[model samples]
Target: MSRRGYARADRPGRPATASAGSAPNTVYPARRSARACEGAAVGADIVIIGAGFAGAATAFHLARLGRTDVLIIEREASAGVHSSGRNAAIIREHADDAAEQALLHAGANVLRRGELAAFDRRGLFIVGPGQDEAARYCPRASGRGTWHPDDGTIDVSGLLGRYLEGQRVLYGVTVLDWTHGAHGLTVRTTEGDVDCRLLVNAAGPWAGEVGKLPLTPYNRHLMVSTPMPWVDGRWPVIWDGYRHFYFRPESGGLLFSCCDETPGRPGVYEEDPKILDTLQQRIETLQPALGAIAIRTTWVGQRTFAPDRRFVIGFDPRDERVFHVAGLGGHGVTASYAIGLRAAEIITGKLDGRDDPFGAGRLF
Candidate 1:
């Protein structure tokens, strides 16, 4: 991995040395052992760790379900500081496995239309000069796959903001450790401590380490090119079915991504030249007309997946008080709201469908 100057930090492997409060690095006083568990009976009702898309969406739905006393703790300075903000070329795919297809369907129902004013309906066109290998998202039809007008993009940060409405998020707070017992859950963070009735693990790539789930992190990189005045924002997202390379309009510029998933631990990822080279090769080979576009920026983020690559969304098999909403992989942005809704169902004991698909019990 080559070093580069870019940010968007999400995964939680870095040590928590900062302080609490509005000021950066302002550490709040740690609670005494007796005071830690002393709070509004059973702490904050709910304490969600990790304020990325998964956590934010869950918190949003939880609020919608009338459980607004949730406390979302984030290690980064703000929400979506990592994977949530880093991923731009997001789309919903109905053509996938049963679980993913279900998630896509549910997610579309929640985010595709209606009140999500931030929804961008540019559509997704999966082109093919080669094989439609990404057919799981869009199976081929005739010589090429048709445009998925139903697929769309969301301002991840903005979505996080919407989900965060009426919710309490403690920014710059890192949960150093937690205790889940019959009484309740007490989370000790770098900033301070909080007790909660239920603990939701939406920690993205760090869920396995933070909540004891068997999840693994894979690093992915995305590039944004210098503005191309001739590029049309009306142009739907174009993706090379075989190359795993996709690009979409970004403020008169373009956001590009390659299928570069390198297995790594949770931590800051140094820029990789090989992935950039892959992006370069993609442009030269397929969209030759956009050859003049130069990459202006790049950054890396992680996508955690379960052993089966499906999202883990139910209460921990070992403990009913612990719930999971992680292991989204690349389907996160597209299916986030749906996962959140599902997580809400699990938390509130109102699940309409079977939760076995993404249940943490599957890990064992």
Candidate 2:
């Protein structure tokens, strides 16, 4: 519904053990002044940077908890303009580790149970051409409890639209700087400044540049096709284990992804033309029937990853008032709710180091 506020009685607990006397690692020189804008001066209990799934979910969880003084700052003209909107939108119960698996399962349940909203479950299929790749996707498939020959796809656009409807989002506003002090955090944005006691850095790909955080970037790509009903809309979300290619149904057409990982600088990145050839070859090997499908349009997006691929959630190591909720890579859509709840719990002191494996200490 609306943006969430902070709890009156239950403020954030004592700063975590690791946050004491720590300072953020500065990278570049800070801008000298704030930007001019028009708006009533607003203050929030929590200020989240980024309007992607991670930030939106955090705002939703906070509202559900009856904490309403939350504001989300997004750089784009609308929400989900980047990775959140660019993804294949497949919800999977599979994870690489116990902690992540739990979050994945929990998020999948939220989608299936209609907690986020009514979502169509076409089911996810991890097609493996050989034994090694099968072994890799098997645990995740087994954990999901459903495996089918057809490709599974989720309605990502529908889910995001539903979740964000009627919510107060400051679109086209970019957070330029933030300072955490004894009083709380003061963030400067492209529009104006927001003063809040708690801050969540749910800024997906640009998380590393958002207020001096320790986040790494990874490269990924996705492509869309012309409307083709012949390609079974019910095709299970296909992952060519051998070629690292994946595809899912979007609207009536098919959306394919080349699971390409490359070294690069972080920011909104465009796709390389060579990736199209790579995707075509992979699709030919994995699903021969769809090889003939024409590629109507294509684009690329960065999938930011942490050092361990597990999410980095919890208070900032250097600043207790600043929180980190990022590094979802391709799992942001699947793990959004769980991660948001966990971040809110940490912010409100409902959860501590003992409750989450994604604590900031992991980065140490």
In candidate 2, position 53 carries an lDDT of 81
TM-score of model 2 (CA atoms): 0.79
CA-lDDT, candidates in order: 0.69, 0.65
Candidate 1 structure quality by residue, lDDT tens digits, 92-132: 68544797788878887677774753677777777754454
lDDT of 2 by residue, 232-281 (tens): 56555655534577676664777777788875576646557698788778
Among the numbered candidates, top lDDT falls to: 1
Model 1 off-target regions past 4 Å?
1-42, 128-143, 352-355
Top candidate on TM-score is 1
lDDT assessment of candidate 1: 0.69
Rate residue 327 of model 1 by lDDT: 91
